[model samples]
Target chain A: MPNNGMGTLLKTPTGISGLDEITNGGFPKGRPVLICGSAGCGKTLFAAQFLVKGITAYDEPGVFMSFEESPSDLTQNFESLGFDFEKLKAEKKLRIDHVRIERSEIEETGEYDLEGIFIRLNYAIDSIGAKRVVLDTIESIFSGMENMTLLRSEIRRLFTWLKEKGVTAIITGERGESSLTRQGLEEYVSDCVILLDFRVIEQIATRRLRIVKYRGSTHGTNEYPFLIDESGISVLPVTSLKLDYKSSTEIISTGLPALDKSFSTGGVYRASSILITGNAGTSKTILAAHFAMSSCKRKESTLFFSFEESPDQLVRNMATIGIDFEQAIQEKMLLIQASRPSLQGLELHLMVLNKLLEELKPRTVIIDPISSLITIGNTNEVRAMLVRLMDTLKKKQVNALFTSLTYDGQSEYNNSTVDAVSSLADTWIDLKNEERNYERVRSLLIVKSRGMAHSNNRHDFIITGKGIQFTTSNKK
Target chain B: MKENTTDVVIIEDKLELTLYISGMSQKSMEAIRNIKWLCDKHLKDAFELEIIDIYKNPKLALEQHIVFSPSLLKKLPLPKRTLVGTLSDTEKVLKSLGITTEK
Candidate 1:
């Protein structure tokens, strides 16, 4: 346990990746926090991670009192998440007490309190000197008892006893129809409360976590999407809302000398986001390939996310335009990730991108035709996801290039999907194909470039064996 | 699991019962008094009663899954039954324990 300062409250680190960032530090120490959710939303897993992380990372012993699952079942379930319950128990670092209650086997005659539970918990905690506790779905006790008044009172007392004992505890509950929990367990453990929601929108399932209440602390109030993989739970915090990312003065070439000359600075700023919007045959992907090739030429690792084309397909197609991506792929300076937009939920895609970014430590990233991702989520959700993606890239000081496909007749200024990234982009390039003399002529325009003087005149260009070449009249 | 060997009077019997209490609290005393009276009046010497104070042995509480204090467990009957709380209702307690009273 550690405090941010002298006057700040003590906090326990959860040790789950990305979770502590949103929680500021972690849950309040030496207090009971309620984690309520519907069936199969990962409440049990969250509590288990809290205790297990406490033991392995903080050297604190823990007690797990399960009211639903048996001890064997709990051990087996947590084993998949890399937690060895038996080993921890053998070392006297963890104690699991399974409280089995069957309503049909009991007949309530007169009056009684839950002294048995208190004594058992006390004995277990004292035996191990546990500092962390998890009562997984303690509300299940309500199912085995006929007296609601007595159970509620006993539960209130149990929380008080836990606090008095000076152990940080997590009490999980089932989601209620009206209140936060079915039995209103939130009414008892009120120090801190978190709600997990599992929702399927448009046939794509997303798990979200929200902090309903956290007394005496400042925290992220937005609903953060989380993922449960083999490693454990990792919450994706909606990144810095303030535009405070560091700026870089270094410029990076676009691999096309003609295109570089179009900007006043001769090249785009390093770590800046660039957007390329064009119609079907306007060569948006080709332009993005040029950016990736330039990054690879500079010996900086580049990550390309291809939504519509596979890696081999992209390489082969780019080769036809005199852009040799095969050499860069072989040199290991470029990594291309190809996946369909419908392959998984939006959050999973973001997680995969994050994992790759962390592992590769790439200096530049490209998403070819980001418009395909719009099909997977609603307008607002897709916008939010892109905003988070851009913010993450900006924070890492990684240059990002995104290509968007505009419909033939849809104005680039009017398309909602393109507008989403265009407003946030530091540089915007619009490409168009028009019929002139029964021949399709492709022209490029620099719509807007922030903090730079760029050519606003349309320059007709053509895809040649040497890549994109500006027509003679437009060249300086 | 059968850890109450201290206060057991006899092993072989038609009715084998274990009463789990917490430090002779008021509820535990009432439950002990009521169960003793019912067993003596109904079964006479055919029953064996074992009283366990969980305060002395708290591990047994978890082993037996005793959530509520003053729990009465009938072990010798074909179908075991658990009754929680103080056994103040004599008729209901006897009837639930499979002992019939003449009308």
Candidate 2:
């Protein structure tokens, strides 16, 4: 009865954690999707997360077909992710069926299809009135079944039946050598093809996801890295193609008095994305929070995306330094959105930002240590995502501040990534921290600014209980 | 670098291939200078050469399948060849394209 459509179409939400945001509401709401990935790349985890999350979060009962893991093995593994499969099972909101497809155990002497797995899945779905389903690595039949011809047709039939059932299903495949999936399952699943990749770069393992194809609906075309932690799987929806946004011309203070004076216009323009690149412990988040407090004082909304610390701890720690975010939160002027960069892919983090911006309509957005995001993706991907993010912020006219931590303070001191957005940016601020003689000191520099004149001198500053008050001036 | 006489010239769309180079890095600039000199001296006008700096027009590189710098894409002719480094080697260049130098 609710009208949430552009025309004669409606959208269904996937209760899967961190997915609806990326798909802008989840797989076109009932279209079958192919989630193919390599072995031990968490295909089972990905499928389970979808089912468990659907049942618990959206009241959408789901059926999970496990071709490999026993139902109990899955229950125990996901239990660590805070997913109570047993509880959901008892609630009758969920169902799990392990289709024991041991080629040696079953003798297919005559012609046959995978109607057995279909019947079992249908029974589970019908019993629960399920709206979501998952076929976990069903392509393992490549190794399990000897008759490729019969199995292929059976797999095709299974997908078609899933369509007839009209539930949004996720069919996961093993990243076998022959194809992107062992059995080349992509040729069959038509709605959306999603590839999950687990790669090791510099000895650090990372998981990434990409939507290879999504028919009818427009989707982001970039590899989005995700992570599996205690909270479950977090997929980054990094690229947003929407350019519709508004930019504010008004300039706002960064809370540091002398720093404000150094700006040719006396302050940073609203909706501008400012990058403050520096070495570790350069007070990046602290400085961003200080400016946020200033904005909140002016009765403007601000959103802080902290990659390093939790929002509560950040607020509490800032309190020790005499910056109280509690009052701002109570006043509805400040909201800190904190998450581990490793918790999800870059896009996932960006989607959260998009959500917060839409909900809070903040005047400013702060990302503490954008550099950590670099670890999750390669150079090109990181640069491309930042450009999109910055472009989105500019369109929104939200004053955006991003902190990038670099190891070498003097060298490679500029923002680096997949693409160069410095040309697209309105202003850039660099924060530097080093031991000057025997005393450790912090300084800020205005690297580049478009449209308005800016002071070029680097000024020394320090953190004392009161806040980030500058020790240098540019007004003279 | 040469506004007077186009740094890149394609004889026609016959030159179906084009190598787009971008960036102000010493490597890219030096490679471009050499590609222009060597390509001009050796290949002459028989083959079309197009050189582009990505920094100036980064969007153009992605449009034409260019991932690295100082790349020479022999276009306007069928079957394109891309070289990441210098565009020297006279004998192979002519023989591959079935060209005979008058000199």
Candidate 3:
């Protein structure tokens, strides 16, 4: 209803590009979220993002209480990620207080409570009018204290206090054997839970995040890929069915009129997803740009999502191929966004795409290499994401085109991204780099084109200063 | 200011839970170490040490009712004597139960 406007935006904003949508307008405002992960799994970073994002985006002052590192250490370490902790502290909008739990300094007298911790937290929160609080690795207290009965009671008290204060707190704990936290902290914060995992698959490190639990609101269960960069934590929760949506119905050409004539119903259908599969250095990106250029020429806006290269690099390289991306960009007909796939999780990547699509409302959307995204997620997750994405594209009637890298060496490793989106796409095209004697030639083939009779033969094509063309065509 | 004494007999019974105390909080870790040191030094010989975890078993502590903490008791020792605070003044710890540190 957009009821309350900006003032009523209790949204946490997540500080991450696309996570807010899946979170249904950020995490449950002031409730606690249990962030459990093994050592060196980016637990502290995730907590830092919460505090940083809260201060910058929501204007909701925050306090970060660390039980591990000192405030100076945190500031220096996180400075690389563009988080000026010092600046935030100086502005009095953010406060970071490190509670060093030195076992030797603590003196157990009689009937003592955690008043010291409570006092420090309160001071920090109150100093900056903080609506958000973070207790990083507070479980160290269990080691510092001998009495579990008192410690357990105090932990519960701390949570109750945070709730009463109406601050959205993030309590990070080391992962336990069976329970969510090593200290069984989940036994406390039962409502919101987020689990971050950094696992190595086939010698490649990939970081994945998933909302394990969210109370009173719907959330995407899929594990989205997140990136921890100089900009802090960027979570890619997959796109949700937003209330605001738009559609298109005008079919765009493939930049080549002859190829467009091959469609039975007159070229590619509007809002239909086209899958173009090829190997590295096989003109996949160039082809995608050409298609976007065609859309731009039609005076319809187009968005190019490039993963293999940078936006500037893509523009420069495409200009060499006579694509004229500069003119398209100047005309506001094309937007080229490029970034490394490893920067964030696949879901985060999809979220970025979702935001870009929403803002730009491009008539034609192009993802240069879908294979990179496929590598970040499991088979089922990738399939589900692609189905949603294609559905969104079709509903918007924005003709979607994706380029996928395929391994032709083994049949088993062929077109994993294609295999993911093929069932959902309205058209599928395969680009092959085949060996003919000593000369390696590039060939294009169409596997299937729904609702149309497409050429089912492998035709060789070349990328010159002008454009791409084929000499032979075979069909029945 | 209360003087109470019991029979001078060593309760020869295996404790339901054999709790151990090793590290002393004197110069070691924290309250856990101090508590451990107190338990190790005093509490007589009736409460035999089983498994001493200055780290692991600290969280799984239960059944014996260790509320005040650093306190020790013989669940099987007849007339279970419950004690709190660091086990200093060894003689006082022994005489409180009408027994000597010697087995």
What clash pairs does model 3 have? A81-A230, A225-A345, A226-A345, A236-A347, A236-A348, A247-A396, A271-A397, B25-B33, B25-B34
Worst 10-residue lDDT window, candidate 3 chain A: A1-10
* DockQ scores for all predicted structures: 0.73, 0.00, 0.03
Highest DockQ, which number? 1
Q: How big is the positional error of residue A28 in model 2, measured in Å on the Cα after superposition?
A: 4.6
DockQ-based ranking: 1, 3, 2
Model 3, A103-202: lDDT tens digits are: 5323344333454466567666776799989999888878856667778887888898888888989999998888778888888887788888888764
Better of 1 and 2 by DockQ: 1
RMSD of 2: 26.4
Candidate 3 backbone overlaps, count: 9
Each model's total of backbone clashes: 0, 25, 9
Residue A71 lDDT (model 3): 87
lDDT of 1 by residue, A1-476 (tens): 54655557889887777777787788888999999999999999999998999999999999999989998999999898899999999999999999888777788888888998999899999999999999988888888567899889989999999999999999999999999999998888778999999999889999999999998888899998899988788898876345898999998898788888889999999999999999887888888999999999999999999999999999998898888899998999999999999999988999999999999999999998799999999888889889999999998999999999899778998887787999999999998888889998889899988888888789988888878888845443
Which numbered prediction scores highest in TM-score against the true structure?
1
- Across A240-309, the per-residue lDDT of candidate 2 in tens digits comes to 5456666567878887767778877788877777777667787877888878988888898988888889
